[model samples]
Target: MLAALVLLLLTFALLLWPVAVTGGIASSLSYCLSALVPSLFPFMVLCGFAVESSAALWLSRPLGFCARYLFRLPDCCAAPVLMGLIGGYPAGARGTSLLLEKGRITEKEARRMLMFCVNPGLAFTVTYLGIGVFGSPALGLRLFLSVTLSAVVLGVLSGLFSPLPSPDKPGAERMESRPGALTRSVEGAARSVLLMCAFLLLFSGLSALLHEAGIFQGAVRLLSRLGVFTPNQWAAMLSFLLEVTGGTGDARALGIGPGFFAFGLAFGGVCVHLQVLAMFRKPPIRPPLFLLCRLAHGLLSAGAFALMGVISPMENASTAPVMAGIYRPELSGGWRGGASLALMCAAFLLMVPGETGKSSLRAPGPKLISVAGVKFPLQNR
Candidate 1:
């Protein structure tokens, strides 16, 4: 059934030479070149660097208390959760997988962490969703805050419920034995960011194709007739389900509501989930459970948005003004600059964990982050 539908859409697109297809391509390109590159690519690079830097190990040290007691996991688990929320998507997955590879977390613990650790980052939310798409920073902030709370609650619950890993399990190979890490991190960050950017472009194109195909319109019309929502509301909801970036854009166009936006964000689009699965290739993940969690999380976010809408006396979502933001390819230094400074500080702070005494200079040097005598390599394993 699905395949047939896809074939029909493709045939129609090819035969009709629809303008919506072109608009999708143009819109995606424009958004990527303008908003995504400036807002997200840098953050992606920063996340990559964070993964490779000794930051993870050092970060775990300071937050070990919370990890052991609050989250009920090893102290090393903190950074992954923190990184995942701040850096977005697979950063948390990557962090958890690294722990498994290192033998710091057992398979069980890693699976549990997977439940709550992953999410789109604050920067991604604020930059792209809040500023670029909605034109309302408040909307973006609400999405970010609501999602953050959900992840945190889920993470804590995951920690409390999941059993802790046994201390006796062997750790991954010692860090010193691995190749130079500094170079690897830089390369890894670049690779991850580029890969992510490619996916965004692909999905953007997909979203446009669907819109031009009339599926979205058809669904919205059908949905609108239900008498519960307007065509615009249905349009936004359907767009969100199909492609997050495209869906959010449609939601913005229709002025559905912030609840829809929050729901869309929590669902994180199929594009992001694919990204998560791609990143967690090794030791096959349990898809059913993950999908269930994603569904629950999205609904939870929607509820939060609705609750906020009720409590706040702000303008209705459809009526609120969207503050326009300009994006420049050049680095003239404003929020981007401040964000860079913050990223640097975070990376620096993450470096604080480990055996305190080895002060090795950056580049070609071995930056070892030792956790309880185990050296966390800077190299991408």
Candidate 2:
């Protein structure tokens, strides 16, 4: 306890020092506030509720047989699997941990599912990469398909080949009975999101420290001397190695090819890996699995995109309009980003006691969100 308090004190001291003024801290804070806080918080809440409320277990019932045979996983894992595909990295980790806590799935199954479910979402692939970066929806779609296919291949192969291990704790295997399941789940999700934000900030500061120390510069100089890559390629590669999100942005700025962009996207860099590793703290899942799967996913995605480039050359999308000025209702307000954002915001706003904002949301038990003439109710049971 003393050590933990000391560590916390040291963390605050560093943030107070040169880190906050640096661009790294600024960028990380900007990302969390503008994008991650609003975007991820809602999904995190929903995911938490999904597992605690038996929503995942209820949904996975019908698909049990297929999931068992095809994926070599118990039907109970279907929730996390689906969440992982849609939610991306750490969603699977979140789900796995949840299921493990519930005793619905063993630690081995959860670990296997972790490798299986993690992937970038359609929004990141299509909206950010496709339209925002490459300026071509087609290129983004191609990258998305490639990454999905690669993840599927890995999951299937691992399912077939790997043998199961005993649960981490033999007796504590299903969800335990507890009061305030809804509140607990929501709080759990909130905690997870906050933790992720912390990791991002820490990584950003560390990256800035490394940069100021000339570590990245030295790496670029050494790599350049190898004569293996051009200046632009080296820049893109270096940025990609340092921070996944910023690296991809740099790679795109350098005019790196679609295949390489896909590679960086799939690789998700060390920043993302740290975010994921942070999620698995309670369960004691292996950290190395996340790293291994990412490398494999990156290689497979890059190869696929490269092959596609050779077969059907991407048109010069340089002239394509940037995504910022466009109205992409499909990408934004659609399932991937928009709807969930609304629901999450509603959940959060309505959570404040006696502050439902209006008479319509002032229900005693739960809240309801009406969209397109349909009512979706949020409740504990």
Candidate 3:
């Protein structure tokens, strides 16, 4: 009820604000809603449901195998990794929350999993942002490497700070298989995807209102004056805070240079983080640790961008050929090859489990309903 009231109040304010009305807020709001509700939201929900039901079980094994062998985390951690990689940020958080609810992962493990679980997919990062928006396939590769590396580093650091029990530990138990688990997984995925999409649309519209009111632009201007950021950097930061696509769009419009673009991509949009946190809230996951991870990501991405800037010429020249080499075949307006490759990679990741023999499983049951018609489920497995 509090959340609903807040949304109502926010919407009322946006509607009444003259500046928000004048700055194309209405149009942007319409566009955002249309994209999310009828298209993106449904797709995401269905995808989540499908993945959780069918793909998760198969994927958990390999993820469990990998995490146990490489990171020493139990099999439970694998679910979040799989969900995050396939379903995007919220999926990861939802998965983590589910694991926590089931007592599959300890609080410390949940915190650490939340830290590095939210990430955009390779297809979205590479195809949409890199090719569609930035017009540089090469930029996509660099951004991919940057974000992936950042996740790995942060994941490791998070583990270091709050280590999970070793496989040999007495409390560490292998995940057990259950009957009809696939169906339950699907339902949980569906619920999570729907909740996430609703919040995403709401926030996406709010972001549009802010943009129209010049609130976002003003914020960018203020940050740019801090001396460390270029106009592009400021725009990227604003977008990151406000919305990922918007920030990336702003960066593309600036056309500052490859260095700045790389920086923006690596940093991700602040709005993306907000959207991610919003999704996690639905599952009632802890937010502070996720925020910490975002902060760390921003810092690391900035440092990486700075380092790239120092050797800008060499990095640019060397990266060009590599980008060309990887994407050369797709230049003829064929996305199938790239799409296929991404699907294959996703499949491989989904299939692999961490070392823990236990499968990270979400229990099958109806979500609890309150007097206000709110249905609360424990977690997304």
The number of the candidate with the highest lDDT is 2
Clashes (candidate 1): 4
> Scored by Cα lDDT, where does model 2 land?
0.67
Using all chains and alpha carbons, the TM-scores for the candidates as numbered come to 0.72, 0.72, 0.63
Q: In model 1, how large is the Cα lDDT of residue 231?
A: 59
Model 1 Cα shift for residue 234 (angstroms): 1.7
Q: What is candidate 3's local distance difference test score? A: 0.54
Q: Give the distance in Å from residue 309's predicted Cα in candidate 3 to where it truly belongs.
A: 7.8
TM accuracy, model 3: 0.63
What is candidate 3's lDDT per residue for 11-37, written digit by digit as tens? 776777655343434444554455433
Q: Tens-digit lDDT track for model 2 on 173-257?
A: 2344355668977788788888877777777776655454445556666677777876556656766655666676556555666
Model 1 Cα lDDT, one tens digit per residue, 1-381: 999998896777756755545555666777667655565555454444444555555555576667777667876677676777777776777667666765667787777777776677788788667766666678788888788778777777777656654322223123412454556655655666566667776776666555445454566566766878665666667667666777665565545667777777777777777766666556445777887877777888877777777887556444233555444455459888788779979888665555765435333553332322333222110
Candidate 2 Cα errors over 4 Å, as ranges: 1-21, 162-180, 282-285, 310-312, 319-381
When summed lDDT is taken over every stretch of 10 residues in candidate 2, the lowest stretch is 372-381
Rate residue 360 of model 3 by lDDT: 43
Query: After aligning candidate 2 to the native by TM-score, how far in Å is the CA of 352 from where it should be?
Result: 51
